[model samples]
Target chain A: MARADVLPLPQRRAIWRVMARRYAHLPLLAPAVAVSVAVFWACMAVLVVMSVYPFLAAGTPRFTLDAWQRFLVDPFYWGVVGTTLRIGVVVTALSLLIGYPTAYAMSKIRRPGWALACYVVLFAPILVSVVVRTYGWLLLLSQTGAVNYVLRTLGLIGQPIPLIFNTTGIIIAMVHILLPFAVFPILSVVGQLTSDLKEAAMDLGANRWQTFRRVTLPLTLPGVVAAAQIVFTLTISAFVTPFLMGGGKVQILSGLIYRDMEAVNLAFASTVALILLALAMAILAASNVLVRRSYSRAEVLRT
Target chain B: MTLVGADRVEDDVELREVSKRFGPVLAVDRVSLQVRRGEFFSLLGPSGCGKTTTLRIIGGLEYPTAGEVVLRGQVVTDVPPYRRATNMVFQHLALFPHLAVFENIAFGLRLRGLPSDVIARKVDDVLQLVDLPGFGTREIHQLSGGQKQRVAIARALVNEPAVLLLDEPLGALDLKLRLQMQAELKALQHRVGTTFLYVTHDQGEALTMSDRIAVMNQGRIEQVGTSQEIYARPQTRFVAAFIGEANFLEGRIAASAPDGVLVSVDGLQVRVAGDGSLPVGAPVTVSIRPEHVKLGAAAAGAANRWDGRVQDMTFMGAVVRATVALASGIAVVAEIQNDAAVGLAPGDAVVAGWAPQHTVVLAR
Candidate 1:
């Protein structure tokens, strides 16, 4: 007899019920996990194999490290990698400087109608096509565009400045596109903060600046780190904004990938793609350390 | 340049005709009170009664719309909370979750630009004072409820301000922990001798911990006195009802005597202790405590006595509360020791009475 048959019928059913409750979430998680493993992981495996093998000739497959070596040793590719990281860092920093204040102001808005309006304004841009938004930036930031026209009318500039077809245009457009990502995480954390903490700090004889530095900023660092990670990865991996705004002037990693793929250089494109993935993983790992450190104190671990 | 009666060095905090209006609602009406140095003063009221608002006004967290806030003999009505010499233990404690216990207590000192060694020493001292000596390195989330309460108190007390404002810091703890913290807080205040301005809606807490309590209702102070005075001789109906349980009997003054006055409630003349100043035929409400109502032979020789039948009885832990209906059909609850009420049950004949002094008369 089976072990389950040794027990009464009700007891056997109760054991099955306990097991169903234990692993109930597995069924709910099936679709997402299935898609991730099938689409994402399977594609990643193909990308890894493609990066190692330069060409697929008829009968026998030939594998070589020449693409990796050539990409790693080249100064031009390294510069492209550096530019990608630099733009990512600058965009993330600028977004935080602008997003923190916006999130703070939104948190302070008491009227629900006004708050909803603010949210609409902040997130509505996300619904628009990224290409259309980049085109809008192009029209505004061009030499004879509205921005230059306004500056010239105010005599702020004697001549039109080069705003497009460069890193500056890419950054401006990318920051605009990715701003909501930065604000959303920080807004959630800021909204959860009670005013009592600020009051407690002031009551302890700390001024406004001191309180912000010692209490407010430290408590919200996890949100800031999360925003930085999201903005950094999105900025680095961005393709269309950089392709349109850079106008072929800025050669970032993604741009290099696009260039190689356009020339049918599949091996080199796969190498660039893997390098970008590695960079993102490194930054995410660093951010995870920061998030864990900040959360270790803020969250209750056990009784 | 000090105004008369306004600058009192003995008073750690004084509010003169302070009022706070939140839009259409008057959160705190024209309220005035004084908190003496080294005394535990409490503002006791139900929620939305403006006790916390009044405390905040004194702490400089809220500005009074029409009056002066004098702290340590200085008119600081417009002074910001950071500039004022007061610290508050918030209702939720509000300890910084990002910092360890030591850093939390040292926040004020560090802001003052104290030396690192001094800050550390002071933090350690306060940690020990709050009975958490080695908890300096512990994160706030690691603490139990009682420990967190102590940490919050320590964080405020370390500043050594002119006064410490506590806004129901013990409101979140369980009953047993709350009672323990109450005793610990009272003893801590006694040891430190810092003037404390406490706000709580718990009457028992206010009575046990406060040297004086200001009973508030509907944005106004009904009365301010010691626990004994506030409990024994409540000046208003709100106070008599809010502070503790009371039996209210509404009636008209029937007659007056040198000893006391008699208030007739539905033709039942209940004698009350007073100077007989109330005119006869005037309306009044008589307040009596259930414990003061004696039943059975214990009602003998009382100034005001009534023969009644037991209508209902409830068994409390140490006492039995028996509701007695008088011959006139008026019901009054009588509390007796468990042993004394053992033989009593519903439908039993009983005499309910109380002394004249035990009856409090309030004008209706």
Candidate 2:
């Protein structure tokens, strides 16, 4: 190949123009990437550094494994980790079960105005602050709340069910808060699916249920997986909803971090925070693998 | 007139005055037609003329807002598609993306809760029937467009439906592939001996593959006849123009005779052989196919000969289409075989005429 400098003047100028055109998007992307790296990664780095600091040291920073060792040995911290994982899995499952049908209905709305109205209703809770919404759930699930009042008047139950200040309350609130995230991805995927496929299924002697099971459900798996991954990751890292709904009874990993930070045990707080991050990453990685497998299966059908 | 009466139990599919309204749009008007058992029937029309809607109505995918659908001598107007003995091959070939070829073909059988071995055997048989024996393990995406089409047909045929409804199944294929599939589909219908209710906008495909065709226009069947009859004796102005190229001459009945009707078009009298239903001095339209319009010395003994100059000549492969302007300033197109007219050119004086029996008279 000829060297760039040895090329003719006009050729060199043309190559320069082409290079400039190809790489022009870099300048536009630089500011956003730089800011994200500086703010987010720098914070993570500082958290990792501080987690290794000596437990009792004051003036000078000294590295030690005390925080990690203490966190690893404590059964209480293990319980918190287990509880957090349970909540994440349960919330993600419940959200998918509820969100898939809602998204399907939204996708089938033919008129744009009606679809927009349905989307607004589905996302209305998300427009409110998470803390406020959790508090709203708290009121709804209270002993004398509307739900209990209706149930009691109907004589379906003799007493009010214990709906708040436990894992049940936290799960219910978190699922409600994270529903829109799940619905949007599934809705978009369902919307992109051609209507002819459904008609074809019906025409091929499949009843509505059979069509859903054999055709629509399998084709929309990628959307389901994507929604699961998003809801699971978000639920694992969520703080405000758990704090408000758990009511001091459900001691999750995030709650432990909060308590440790309030007691000025910075090293301990950092250690728990890092463990939470690792657990979230583990779930996300597994979900990503599941998504890729399902995606490849879907890609095969597209051909 | 109804093609099939309620007593015609041999008819596989019958639409008796079927009508469908989607909001304010009338998709299918009061259409009545029939498909004889084991016949290859086609619903041919332009887009938005309700051919697909009529196919759907016959398949029981859409219930008629008025009239009845009789499938195999049973009134099935309210029956769902799954319960009806008909399966449709969609235009886009909607193969299930998640399933392999075997599963797609076995879908209907599996829904009926057949044994796994029986489903497998039926799927294999259908695969052989469509000529794709070893494609069971392959995903739908692995198949080419033509292969996908074959799979879709196999998926429907494995059910052993009384009638197989096809909604423009070859509309997506290239011209060469479409022609190949058209021939294969006709042969398949013959081998299976099933009533095939097909839909298409392409007149060539319709004429080539169908034993009989229902020419539809504006949500109504303009005429229903064998391909030869449809081409030779179209009943209405729409069918005459929609099926093939026709040179229309606006006229009125000058006189009625026992042999033929005399129509005067722009002061030129032309004799047309048909049942003289219209009285003298009534408005009418005369349609003549281009191939019947002889040119030059070939027009010597024709009774309705007119001297015209060729305005334009298009050299098609087998024939040359010439646009000739008559002495009355009306343009008539004549498609002459290239072998017969070797050096015909524009601005040449020509006499274009056709036998009086070939002229089709229609109400305006």
Candidate 3:
């Protein structure tokens, strides 16, 4: 309190002042926010409406569980689910096994700009059309292809292995495409770790192998889970890789949906698409739960 | 990496004329120093003064370009950090994120293929020593900052290196925490009685913790002495200015007496007694600590007296400092107790003086 009610102008500290919020300008964003909510509701309504359609025949849509029942009872439909799950699991595991070290190397690279350039080159193939990227793999994994040629030259095999136009080809191509997504998440994760932590461990008494197994691997698990989630979901919903590389030999849920739609069976196609969506969500939900449990455990041990 | 316990007291590590060049810059000039068994030594200086570089050289994190680093009299110039008998606590602490505190502390033991039981025992011992006993199973993120620092110290100390190097270990903590950790660290060092080579730019830290501090400047050590010696009688201007606050007055010897010299500054003579390598008529600078200067109407109470105008007075907690200008136009700062005093306005006349022997003479 002061005689003039001045109060000494209460210390104008740099950190004490709160930044003024932009609430004064909120009216400008009101339309966009409203539109976004409306669009989201519209899409949900459409998905539900399409899911309940009884037939591909036009006119009024009717509610029915016939397509859902068909999907549940058919052994082939369940096999597609199994195949999708298998591919997703294999791709995620392979990415982790191969991607962890790749991400590790990328993070440790002395010349990061040059390493980033290399990463860009490695990531270039992921950006190309899936059909083209799959075809490129097809050309490589084919019987008399470049892979066989190089292997033969190196004396690894007497002849080409039966690889292309099968699940093997589909998996190979899908992994190549999905690897970048996995690698990016993990590389960013590994980048966050200071190499000093590893050095500290080594100085404490850990050797090279133990340091990797104990410190490096566990520290980068969040990146691994994030990468797994992205790669698994992307691989599960992949239609082009299986279409181009599977050559009809590997009829995944996406490909089956495509075929059903081509045969004018919109209801069956939608049903298959819905099941694919559900399976992907289930896998993601399970993986998320696993990650959370491990994360909390890691967190607990850290303290 | 064999310097330990009883053997460490017998000159464990030696750097002989060791120098390092980073590109065109000489990060560490040719400098030779030795670590005695169970002695605590510090390389103290400001940032880029090469104290950390020298510590890194000793740690084998950075190799010397010229001289050899001898460990237990055996040259370890080519040896790596892990192969040396030393562990360093980095400024950042660098605790492993994913590992439990126990596992992080036990990491080194596990690498040597120790049984899990042994590792568990060693980790427990270190945790107990650091006062975070039974905290081995906690996650790194869950630990508070101070606990994390303790974990880092425990992690490094568990290896029982003959020489433990700490690079500004207390830098990350707040002021109060830093002050508390300083005593604990010093006590820990005394208990272990190993050769501790610590690096710090903080003058207070170096003076408080080190048995002998090697004051460094521009990639070279200016002086190595105990804190009392470094503070009471610094050999160089840099050490005097860096260690504590001082008022430097440029002068020249006007007359040489039996046991002192009459220094002429501006137009008046200041009776300064010093034992330094400076000749009569040689340009010199007198460094007098601020606290030694007395202020008031001490017109006849000092060897030298000057009438000065009180320019400003700042009341810092615990101490009050006044800027006074001599009649001959030389300004000197004096610090006094900050308790409520009979104050004078800024333009008031004042007399300031100091005893003869309180001044230190520097040639360059």
Candidate 4:
């Protein structure tokens, strides 16, 4: 009775076959993803080994805490980290403030072609070498350079103030170099926003400022966080701009790492590089969390 | 009681020969129209017909290339939307994603620099008016499409703008939601009695909601009159064909007189009356609505009649449509409702006729 009511063997076999077919894409996907993940984990393992290994001299294989101790105990190393972080934080904040309005103005252009032209101008400096831009800033900010020449002509200053080869020059150079990277992501995010919300708010009796505070600012926050993360991480890791502009007087972690590498202090340099990487990763993670929160909130609003 | 003014100072809108051009495209041609105080007026047209553009010009979102915009008979061409006493409910609704329902509704009041207490009270009153009183705490995403639309209305209305403009506000909704909103919006307009300028491509929406309809085409107003007038006596061929279902008979005028004109299409000749002012031998198109065409008529008050064979019968739940082939071999369709008892089947011989008064005359 049960056999008569049951399905045929071919039908049962076909059902089994369909179940097996569910994972047909697995084999084709296995190699490339597996290899890439393996490569990533392998690289991480090498960095971990180098950081924990002892001995400051390069080309020596030894296990020691000497390098870590030297990094933590030295005030100079701490100063480099502090300066790099300070600059990175300031640059990221300014970029967000400046980026939002530029993006808003760009989005308001009636023609898409003109908007694209604005983007090119905003993004062109990024294509130029950071070293070259830094050199340009170096010449401009020099005591006897164009900056002083202009300032003196305006009678703003009687004597040429210290400008290039200092902390101020390094900050200015770093900002110019990182401004595009900071702006583009935010502009893309803002460009996705429709003017409808702003217009609707204004129509509802909201003033221009109120519309921005209530709608424009909150919606573009995810982009702001993303831009901040990129700017922060990139600024901390920047070696060339600071090296050229800081002129040994203002030292950041990347410059210290460079000096350590040249001195063949491989273990010390590795330790510093590892610390820089970890700090950057932490900042990136925090920024990512902020962005995720805003995005989810936006999703909640959208739904 | 806090007394500001008996009527909100900012509740009026007008456009005087306003024109807007985007490079080569004249989006909204020199369109000049008036919305009476507390009248629900609609600008009706198809896509790219400049209805929305005209509304935007009135809202101060788009500046007219020429002419002036007056609100309450005062020139406000330079006034920004934020400074005007008019609010817009966007086609997309454009509700604030960051704010909850209450905040969105109260945004306008807040912008006027009103005290928080007054804003909260006004928002509450409007939210209740829209039947979403307790749902003020709900986020925009949490609300249904209809609910979002209601909130958008509440936000616009709370500020008590003299004029309220809706730019296809229910266009994004599904059919059921759109119908529900139509009734809701009609009720809302009557309740507030603010000068309302509505833009829509949906003729049904305009007919159902507007006190008056302005039929627009190519940035110019083809006709402006009451919905009934516009529907019944369409001034142009575009209005009749666009506003409702009308079969166009492209023909040449065989005879033209002060009282009437005979239009010959293919081999069938139709006498079009009440058509304004035409010369003899001029080309003209005659338009007749399907329902208005008489089938097997005895006394439909029709002055003209034609004998033809029934070629096809289409069942439309409320009405049955039959196509009749005249001796001239030209087919004309006549619609009779199921309840109207169109008993004739295909291949049956019948006489199709219509009244001269019901017949409208239009140009090519």
Q: Identify the candidate with maximal lDDT.
A: 1
Task: Give the C-alpha miss distance for residue A33 in model 4, angstroms.
Answer: 7.6
Residue range B1-364, candidate 3, lDDT tens digits: 5545564437767788888899999988877877777878999999998988888888777878999887776778887676777888898988776667887787667666788888888888889888998797888888887898888888878878878888888898999999999888899888877678989889999889888888988888888888988998887899999999899999898888667888888887888776534677899888888887887754358787788899989888888888988887789988877652257557888888887888777775
lDDT of 4 by residue, B1-364 (tens): 1233424234355577788999999988888777778889999999999988888888889888998887875677888888887888888888888788888887777767889888888888998889897988887788888898999888888888878888999889999989988998899888877778899999999999999999999999999999889988887999998988876777887886467777778876677776446776678777778888878755255766888888998998888888888787777778887755456888888888876666777877
Docking quality tier of model 4:
medium
The Cα error of candidate 3 at residue B163, in Å, is 2.4
The lDDT for every candidate, in the order shown, is 0.90, 0.89, 0.80, 0.82
- Using TM-score as the measure, the top candidate is 1
Candidate 1 residue pairs that clash: none
Name the better of 1 and 4 by lDDT. Answer: 1
What fraction of the reference interface contacts is present in each model, in order? 0.87, 0.81, 0.54, 0.83
**lDDT-based ranking:** 1, 2, 4, 3
Which sections of candidate 3 miss by over 4 Å?
A1-84, A105-119, A140-145, A149-158, A264-275, A297-303, B1-9, B22-25, B71-74, B252-282, B294-328, B336-356
Put down candidate 2 lDDT per residue, A57-106, tens digits, no spaces: 47678888889999999898788889999999999999999999999988
TM-score of chain B of each: 0.97, 0.96, 0.91, 0.91
Find the 10 residues in a row with the least total lDDT in model 4 chain B. B1-10
lDDT of 4 at B152: 84
Off by over 4 Å in 4: A1-53, A56-77, A97-129, A153-155, A207-209, A261-271, A286-295, A299-303, B1-12, B247-287, B297-301, B325-331, B339-343
Over the stretch A89-144, how does candidate 1's per-residue lDDT look in tens digits?
A: 99999999999999989999999999999999999999999999999999999999
lDDT of 2 by residue, B1-364 (tens): 2365555867898889999999999999999998889999999999999999999888877878899998888888888887888998998888888788998898889888999999999999999999999999998888999999999999999999999999999999999999999999999998999899999999999999999999998899999999999999999999899888999999999998678899999988898987899989999999999999989988888978999999999989999898999988888889999976776788988888888889999998
Candidate 1 residue lDDT tens string, B232-268: 9888899999988888888999999678898999778
**Residue B282 accuracy (lDDT) in model 1:** 92
**lDDT winner between candidates 2 and 4:** 2
Error of 4 at B312 (Å): 3.6
